[model samples]
Every structure is written in C-alpha cells, then in structure tokens.
Target: MKLKQAVTGMAVLACMSTAAHAQSAGTFFFSTGWFHLAPQSSSDPLTVTSIGGSPTNITEANTGASLSSADTIGFTGGYFITDHIATEFVIGVPPTFDLEGSGSLEQFGKLGQAKQWSPTLLFKYYFNAPTASFRPYLGLGVSRVSFTDAKITNSNFEANVLHGPTSVSTDSSWVPVFNAGFTYAFDQHWFAGVSISYLPLSTTAKLNSTSTTVVGTLNIQSQTKIKLNPIVTYANVGYRF
Candidate 1:
C-alpha cells in the first residue's frame, strides 16, 4: 500500500511541474510566421473634379481600380498576465500591393502601388488547463492601418489621360480586429500555432493632377472610396521563456 501511494504521489508531482512550466504569470513569448492577406476589395465610383469643369463620376466597374493580394512575413510577441490571459502585439514588414484595372481600364494595366503598415494590439483569453497541449484562444483588438508610397505607375495614363503631373494619396484610419486561433505545444518551451483575423477596413484615395491646358494650370481632384475587408491568416513557430 505504501509503494502504491508513493508512485501516485510522484505522478501527481510530475503533472504539477508540467502545468507550471506551460503557462505562468510573467512568461513571455515570441513568434515568427508567414502571413497572407486576402482582401475582399471594393471601391466606389471615382469622383473627378476639374478647376474649369463640373465634377463627373467614373464608375469603378468602368475604371477597374482594384487591389491585389499580398503575402509577407509576420511577427507577434506576448506577455502572460495570468495563466489564462495575455496581451499580444502583432506586427510585420509592411506589405506592398499593386493597384490594377479590371473592366474598362484593364488596358491601363498596373495603375499604381500602395504600401501599408498595420500594427495590432490584442487582449487574448486562452481556454483549457495550462497543461493541455492544445489551447484555443479568442482575441479582440484594434489595428491602425496607414497607407504610404502611393503613386501613379502608368506613364501613359498620366501623360495622355491626365495631361500633366499626377500624384496619389490614401487616407489612414483605425479599425477593430477579431481573432481566433489555436496553439499546440511541442514541449514546455516550443510551440506551433495558426491564427485567423478579420478586419473591416475602409479608406479614401485621392488623386491630384496638375495640367497645363489651354485653361491654364488646371488643378484636377479625384477621390475614391475603397473597402478592404481582409481575412488574414498566419502560421507560426514560437518559443516561451
């Protein structure tokens, strides 16, 4: 009977040790991964205004101002505030996307390029016991998406279409992000995970053109609304310390 009790006690001690090592307060984790951004992109009709003429609307289906998908490396870091709660920061190298024309402007090919940098902050709740090899998590977060390096890439469109120097700019905005994922622990310190997030992001793009026409330096303004509801996916290998 004493031998049996001793064996059970040792087993219990081992289980406790594993649980403690898995997740504890003050533990820090870092993850690096590959990410893909697939955007369900849509745009409003381009509204064009000329200094000498009335504003006119160009339909998106006619202009084809759509963006393409992007893939890049992503990173995340987290701090376990408790055994079941953590705060994480998600970031990565900014991804560049090519703006393309589809319907009427399809012949114009690539219209321009826009690069975005979005960093997110999340408060996550992990489920199951800390000793469990697999834990699913849910997170609510905020992401700030800013666009830069937006320029007109098609020389023909600028010279023939605009008849002058054209510049492009995008408006920045903040949005909410929703996340769901699971992490599998290979050991106490190493793990692998996959995450999925959705962000309902929207912005306005402005195109400014200066043309030396018979009417003088004609200042033309064009604006478009772009809706990018992107579903982002990540596969990561992580370590905890």
Candidate 2:
C-alpha cells in the first residue's frame, strides 16, 4: 500500500513540473513596454568647412551641444531557438530629442531638436530552468541609428551666429548594444520584464545656410561631430504563444 502511495505522489510532482513550464523551444512571443533614453552626450566644436562653395577654416567657441533625455513606446517580438536561447527584434516610435548648448554656448539654453530612429536585433541567452517563474538574461545586438527633422530652433543663435536661415542634415550609422534584463512569469503565457541597454553611438550634423552678404550671395556650410552614448531602459509585459 505504501508503494502505491509513493507512485501516486511521484505522478503528482511530475504533473506539477509540467504545469510550471512556461517558455520552451519553438515558442513565439511578443511584448510592449515603456522605453526611456538618456544620453551621455558631448560634441566637437562647430566648424565651418566651406563658405560660398570654397573651403574655409572657421570654428565657433562653446558651440558644442548636448542631448536631453527622451521617452517613447517600445516593442519586442521573438522566437525561442531553444529552451535557453532566443532572438528578438526591438523597435519603437521615433522619439524627439531636445538639443541644448554646451560649454561656452551653455548660456543660450536651447540649441536645436531632432528625431531619432534605431531598430535593433538581439541574441539573448536566458538563465535558469524554463519552469522557473523568474529568469534573467544577457543580450548582444546591433542597432541601425539615424536622425531626421533636424533644425536650429533658437532665433537669435540662427540669425546672429549662422548669418542666415539655416537648414540641417545628419549622418547615420550602426552601433553595438549591450543589454541585461529579467522576466517574471505570472502564469504559463503571461510575463513581465525589465531591461537596460547601453549603446556607444555618434553622428555628424551638417549645416547649410544662404545669406546675401556685401560680398554677394554666399552659401555657408558647417558641421559638428556628436558622441551620444546612451543608456536605455525598458519595462514590459508579454504573452507567449
């Protein structure tokens, strides 16, 4: 009779184990969340490379800039390659960032504004058993970064310093991302997670302005290099299928 009771207890434990299993191979999942970006930013001195289609050497003092923090909605989708390995695609609505003058230019307060787009692909390794309610992960990834709608917003700075109405452009590039996070499974199909990532990124902003000077019509071109190594955070809730 004791042997029969032992067998029954073992069967019950097996059933419990199966019930606790949440993530597994070949499963597809999606998540939506809050995303925040804070830039550790700096810039090179603003330099004029050309004036009226001719090369010139001119730089502005304290004209380097810094980016303010931004927030947006974030999304992620992935498929489990194995019980411990997954690949995810992450993206968000392009967030608008404010630019403020730095160094000698700090007194001006506001400098400009731009919108950023960075979509990422990550290979993540999850730790702990699939049946465990909580799991932590580390990810390595690449993000394609770009900017748009860049413009000088301050009137005094634009007219006096730039010499005319100025239009702006920017260069884009790809960068490496380092990520770490944890997820807690509320049930077999529902989970919540939080992650933080760092990106070492930089870009160049090109400026073009047209002015009717005493010398005649002049086209001025200038540029600056900005290093925007950012720390990003995401908090999410997900569902597994």
Candidate 3:
C-alpha cells in the first residue's frame, strides 16, 4: 500500500510542475485594457504677429497651453522568448485631446483639438521564477506619436488674433519610453497587470493666416514649440497561450 501511494504522489507533483511552465517560456500573450495619457506639458516662448499689425511676445512666464487628460481602449501582443525575457507591441484606438489656453492666452479658451495615435514597441525583462504568482518587469521602448485632424476651436481667437481665416497643424515625431510594471497571475493562463510609462515628447504647432480687406491684404505665419512630456498608465487583463 505504501509503494502504491508513493507512485500516485509523484504523478500529481509532475502534473503541477507542467501547469506552472504553461504560463511562461515559449508562451504568447494578448491583452486589452484601459489606457490613460496625462500630459505634464509646457511650451517655449511664443512670438506672433500679423502683417501690418503689432507683434506680441509671450515669454516663458506667459507662454502656457494646458492639454486635457485623455483615455482609450488599449491592446497589446507579446511573445516570450525565454522564461524572463519578452517582446511586446502596444497600440490603441486613437483619442482626441482638447487644448486650452493658459497664462497669456487664457482669455482665448478652448484653443483647439487634435487626434493622436501613439504606438510602442518594447523589450521587457521579468524578475521572478516562472511559477511565481507575481512578477515585476522593467522595459525600454520607442514610440511613434502622430497627431492629425487638428482644428482651431476658438472663434474669438481667429477674429481678434489672426484677423481672418487661419489654418493650424502639428508636427509628428518619435520619442523614447521607459516603463515599470507588475503582473499578477490568477491561474496558469490568466493574469492582470498595471504599468506606468514616461515619454519625453516635443512638437511644433504652426499657424497660417490670411485676410483680404479694404487695406490691401494681411498674411501671417507663426510657430510654437510645445513639450508634451506625458505619463501614461495602463490596467489590463491578459491570456497566455
């Protein structure tokens, strides 16, 4: 009876070991969740003027634009090449961001809006055994931030400031991203995670204006450098396959 019981106990242990390995090494994962972008933003001195009009300089003390926080549905796909190393691609449904004038341009209010698509590629290293229920990871990545569909929203800004019809646009660029996160495994195939990432991003906003009046014509072109260094956060549930 003792010999039979020993054989059964070894069989159960072997099954448990297999279950633990199923979550790591050579696994593929997919996740979907909430992603939020909170911009800690600022801008350089703004110098603008209209042709045949007075020029105004908005200094560092007076140059400010506040970006509203935005959220969207986020998705990620990952492949584990080893027990501790993985590669991931993160993407999301584009989100619209509202820009409000602050400091010198505070009176303008709701200056404009733009749509953003930011996609990232990451290399991550997890710091725990494959069987552990919890793992913490650190990642380094690069992101492509593209801004499109920009529109000027404030009427007064156009009539009073630009003196006529105006067109606005933003430049797109790439930036580095740093990530720190943790994952909690619920079972062999199910897990949940939360991550925080920082991106130091910068862009330029350009405006072109033209007015035809009794006094011939007036035209103006202006550019403003904006720093949109943002902290991005994510909360997700995933399946390991």
Task: Say which candidate scores most in TM-score.
Answer: 2
**Candidate 3 accuracy as lDDT:** 0.84
If scored against the real structure, what TM-score would every candidate get? 0.89, 0.92, 0.89
219 in model 2: Cα distance from truth in Å? 0.8
Q: Under the 3 Å rule for N, CA and C atoms, how many clashes does model 3 have?
A: 0
Task: Write one digit per residue (lDDT tens) for candidate 1, span 59-162.
Answer: 43465468889999999999989988999999979999888866666788888888988999999999987778899999999999999898888998777765
lDDT per residue (tens digit) for residues 1-241 in model 3: 9999999999877756765675577989999999999988877655563345656443335756778889999999998888899999999899888888888778888888998889999999998888888999999999999898887888887777666787888888989999999989887788999999999998898777787789877777666787889899999999887
Look at candidate 1 and tell me the lDDT of residue 230.
88
- Residue 86 displacement in candidate 2 (angstroms): 0.5
> Each prediction's Cα lDDT score?
0.85, 0.91, 0.84
Give Cα distance to truth, residue 10, candidate 2, Å. Answer: 8.1
What is the full ranking by lDDT, best candidate first?
Answer: 2, 1, 3
Query: Which of the predicted structures, 1 or 2, would earn the higher TM-score when compared with the native?
Result: 2
